[model samples]
Target: MIAVLFAILTAFSNGSASVLQRRAALEVPHTDAVGMSLIGHLLRQKVWLAGIGLVIVAAVCQAVALATGPISVVQPIFVIELPATLLLAGFMMRAPLPRPVWLGVAAVTLGLALGMASAAPGGGSSAVHGAAWVPALILTGLVETLLIAGGLATRGNVRAALLATAAACAYALTAALMKDAMARLDGGGGAGALFTSWQLYATAAAGVGALFLLQNALQAGTLVAVQPCLTLGDALISVLYGVTLFGEDLRTGWWVLPELLALGLIAAGCVELARSPLASGNATAPARARRVD
Candidate 1:
């Protein structure tokens, strides 16, 4: 329960950061998108800096959640980030959310609750066992490589979806690595062991890689193309990692029905929310423009 609370807090923080950063990004010239000039411009924006600060806070909350709960449980809760972001954007912009947006939010909330209750993910080890990491890392790398290559070969929405999928995989891998590193501390290995673990460094690398892929995805296509893939892919892949690598137990057989239904609802909600102007980076557009075709 404590882990779930922290995960929710993390989602809220990340959602708020996304809205703030998007607002700040809109102030910069589009010509600056490709280089360090973009970062230089953003560094001058207080809104962007606040977003970065929230991102750091989210990371701390995520670390705490992973340390206390199964990765399967902690990571899936991030599916709410989209809904949270839309709601936050609406509140910040003083725009009343449309009916579909509210429905989407309800769907996501209910689906997440139903899924957690039905799946009951538990019995995972805090730390991964030896030799298990070898095959997992190799397979993950191969999958991400294929996704990135496919994304590079494509254009438009196809490129965005593929790149977002790659980013999702990297984010999931980062969470798994973070959990393993945090486990070292729980196991009485101390700060020395935590810093020395390869997983710690790998976590940082994977997180940065994920951020890069996500940025490329955003540039390639609309949120309709990237958001659902990013949200659902991360949750599902993280669950796979938890089950395979961390030995997290989830209900199977008859219980799979509700789990599948929950996933469907979550996916539908994500798609609906992603289509909204609030979630698609158009929250600041003129009301007349929003009302037009």
Candidate 2:
């Protein structure tokens, strides 16, 4: 339960960070498609720096959650980040969330509750094997490579979706490695050993990759499309990593039906939320245009 609480805190931090960072990123002057200069520009923004601080907090909370609970348990809880982000963004944008948006929020909340209760994921190993890292790293690298390539080949929403998916995959890999690193921290290995762990380095690298992809995604298209794919992809991929790498077990048999139904509800709700005027940028267009004009 404590782990769950920490995970919830992580979700809140992540959602708030996303909104803040996106706002900052949008304020940046248009630049090259993908370059360090773009990142340098964002780094100078106070709002973006604040968002990075929240990201650090979120990472610490996530590490604590992974240390104390099954990765499956901790990761699935990130699904809440979507609704949290929407709520925070709605307030910042000063747009009244429509009735459908409220309904979508309810559906997502109920679905996550029902799904988690039905699935009951538990039992996982943090003692990662050398062989385990090989396949996981290779697969994650290949998939993210493909996603970046595909995203670069496209434009508009398609590019955003691909980049966001890549970012989600990178984040999932980071979390998986982070679980191992955090587990080491709890084993009385001392700070030196923790710093020397390969998992820690891998986690940092993956996190950087995820951040790069995320910025590009935000620049590519509207948040309406990018945010949902990022949210859902991260949650689903994290579950996959938890089960595959951590030896976690998800409920099966008759329980699969309800889990599927719950997932459907989440999907539907996310779609509805993504279509909101606020999300699509229509709600704030007049004000933005006036500022530009």
Candidate 3:
């Protein structure tokens, strides 16, 4: 249960942090993606640094949860962070949210709560021991390679969101992968035991690479558009892997379809809220000035 709880907290924290960062990014316009990222970095240096620290905390929590719970349990907890984020943004950043936005936020939270509570999910990896460095290297390489190729083929918003979605996917996968990596290290595996890794390098590297793309996406589009897309995209990708591949073993009962329906409602509502200027960076209301760190 500790694992499940922590995963939930991590998801919430990550979403909240992303929302804050997106808002801060909005402070400047007329800048290119690289330029905007740089400026945004400068504008919220202290805040982002705190956020980085929070991410460290989140990483720790995720590692713990993955060790104890099924990937299905863990991943859902992480995905729910989107709603937690909206609440956090409301309190810390004073982000102006309309009634519709609040309703959308409620939908996400409700859907996530139901989804998480509805089933028995079981899962296990091939090994309890391996080298961290190996997985970190491999996953990161794969994601970066994919994006670089995609970037060459695409432009405009597609280019940006694709990177962001990739980054979000990487993040979701990273948590599970890092948890696996940590499991190995804890069980007395030395750094030299590189070959015994399950898929550490692949997952870790993928997660980091995805983060790089997310920054690019944030640079290209408004937080309103990018955040929800990333949130939903991560949920879809990670959960699919968890259920179909990880053998999360979640039992779909009476609530499964309803839960899925709720989840969709929440996602749609979030998108609708994001479309509003008041919920967006360009029109960040006066109340939204609080730092989400």
Candidate 4:
């Protein structure tokens, strides 16, 4: 339960950060899709800095959640970020969420709850085998590179989705590595031991890469184009990592139906929410138009 609370907080912090960062990214001009110059420009913006702060908070919460719970459990919880981001974006834009949007929100909430309850994921070893490290990192790097290349080759929403997918992969890898690092920390390995562990550094590197890709995604297109890809891709890939790398397992048989149904609800809700006017990040009315009598 404590881990669930931390994961919820992580979602809120990350969702808020995404909105702030996206807003800031759009305000700046970019010469290239994934250039360092764009990140440097974003770094100068106060709003982007604020977003980075929230990202740090989110990272802390995520770390605690991963340390205390299975990745299968914690990663699915991140799907909440989509609705949370939509809400924050709507509030920031001073746009009221419509009835259908509310319905989508409810669906996501209920589906996530049902899915988690039905999955009943079992705990697993946090520390992955030393031999698994090289292959896992290599595969993750290759996938990220491919996604980034594909994103750079495209334009508009397609590009954003690709970049967000790449970012999701990086984040998923980061969480897996962080879980390993946390496990090491708790295994009587003093704080200094983290410095010697490759997982710590790898997590940092992946996290930075993920942040860069995310900012690019935000700049490439609207949140509607980016959020769903990031939200879903990360969750699914993290579940795979939890199962393959950490040996976690979920409930079987009768529970499979609810979990599948829950995924459908989540998918439906994500699509609906992403198609809503207010979620477009450009549908906000003018300041005076928002003034109530």
Candidate 5:
């Protein structure tokens, strides 16, 4: 329950960060995509810095959540990030959300609840066993590489989706690594052990890489294209990592039906919410127009 609360807080913080970062990314030149120049340009933007600050806060929340509960339980709750993002965007734009948007939010909320209840993810270890990280890291690297290559080979929404997927995978990996590092502390290891863990450094590296990919994704296309992939991919991938690497238990057999249904609802809701004007940065246009008028 404590983990759930922190996870929800992390989702909201991340959602808010996404909106601010997306806005800042849109102002950067497309030519700077996937390069140091992009970071250089973003550093000049106060909005992006504010977003980064929120991201740091989210990270702290996420670390706490992972330390307290199973990664499977902690990570899947982030599916709400999409709905949260749209809601925050609507608030920021001072736009009244339409019926479809509200319905989308309901679907996502209901689906997440149903899914978590049905799956009941638990029985995960706080630390991963030896030699497990080797195979997992290799497979994750290959998958992320393919996604990045495909993203680079595409344009527009295709590029955005692929890049966002890669970012999602990186973020999931970061969570897993963070959980392992936090375990050192939970297992009676002091700050020296925690700081010295390779997982700690890897987590930092993965997080920075994910942030870069996310920036490029935001620049590549509309939030309509990026948000769904980012939110859904992160949730799914994190669950996989939790189950496989962390030995988390999820219900099987008859429970698969509701779990499948839950995923469908979540996916459908994400698509619908992503299509909203608020999510796509269009809601502010009317506000600006009214101001002009």
Candidate 6:
């Protein structure tokens, strides 16, 4: 439970941090995409640094959480972060967010939490095999690479959405692998165990690379579309990994019916809000329009 709590905290914190990071990224002016990213190299800035600091803190919290919880439990919290990010962003800088943004966040959070609750939090008959993760890790990497390539091949808002989705999927995969890594260590496995652990480290690298592309996507698109779509990626991936790789189960009883309904509502809220005018694909970022800041 403590692990779950920390993972939730980490997700929320990171969500808030990304808003600031994206805003900072938006501040750079450019004649082309490269020029915008290069603006920082040509000068100095602190906000993006602060965003990095938050990511580091989030990572530490996540690491500790994984050490304590099951992967199925840990991954859902990553979904919670999308809603948390909107909430955090308001408190940090973008106060007075339109109702739609809040609505989207709420939907995502509810859907994820309830979906996991519908599953067995702990008990299941099938066990995850240690060796199977090797291929899982490789496959995840290849998928992200394909997404990145595919996103690059697309145009306008669609490309941004694809990339952002890649980022969220990356984080989700990392969260799953991280929980697995922690599980291995708890079983009395040591550093030498991890050194030979190609899967764990490989997933970690893929996650990191995915995040890099996500940051760039944030700079180019509306948060409304990006945040929720990206968030959806986490929920779906967690569900996939949870049942197949982690042995998480589903509950079937009178209460389960309503729980499932509620989750659908949550997803509805998230998707509806994601495409709102406040975060529509063509909407101009407040900070991006200005040449000097």
Top of the candidates by TM-score:
1
* Candidate ordering by TM-score (highest first): 1, 5, 2, 4, 6, 3
- Which lDDT tens digits does candidate 3 get at residues 1-293? 77778877677656655665655555545463475567655555666566666667777677677767766667655545545555566666666566876777677677677666665556655233335436644664686578657855787666666666666667666655655565565567665443477556766665656666666776776665565667666666556556544545665767678767757875676675566555454554311211111
The regions of model 4 sitting more than 4 angstroms off are: 18-52, 89-94, 152-156, 218-222, 283-293
Model 2, position 140, has a per-residue lDDT of 85
Kindly list the per-residue Cα lDDT of model 2 for residues 1-293, writing each as its tens digit: 87899999988888788778778877777763268887888888999899889888987899888888887788778877767777877787566777998888888888889889999988878656558878888888899889999999999999999998898888888888888887777678877778989989988888888888887987898765676677667778988998888888999999999998888887787777767765554554111100000
Can you list the residue pairs that collide in candidate 5?
none
lDDT of 4 at 262: 90
- Better TM-score candidate (4, 5): 5
- lDDT (Cα, tens digit) per residue for candidate 5, span 69-155: 988888888888767877777776566889998998999899999899999899879999989999999999999999999999999
Alpha-carbon RMSD to native, per candidate = 4.6, 5.5, 5.7, 6.2, 5.9, 5.7
Q: What is the Cα-based lDDT of residue 119 in candidate 5?
A: 92
Local accuracy of candidate 4 as per-residue lDDT tens digits, 177-289: 88889887787977878778888898888888888888899789866677678777787788889988999998889999998899888877877777776555556511110
lDDT of each: 0.85, 0.78, 0.60, 0.79, 0.83, 0.62
User: Could you tell me how far off, in angstroms, the CA of residue 126 lies in candidate 6 after the best superposition?
Assistant: 13
Worst ten in a row by lDDT for model 2: 284-293
Clashes in each model (backbone N, CA, C under 3 Å)? 0, 0, 20, 0, 0, 2
For model 2, the superposed segments whose C-alpha errors exceed 4 Å read 18-52, 89-95, 280-293
At residue 272, candidate 6 shows an lDDT of: 62
Please identify model 1 stretches exceeding 4 Å from their true place: 26-41, 285-293
The superposed Cα distance between candidate 4 and the true structure at residue 291, in angstroms, equals 31
Candidate 1 clashing pairs, residues 3+ apart or interchain:
none
lDDT of 1 by residue, 29-81 (tens): 98998699999999999998998898889999999999999999999998888
State candidate 3's TM-score: 0.70
Q: Which residue pairs clash in candidate 2?
A: none
lDDT of 2: 0.78
Give the winner by lDDT: 1
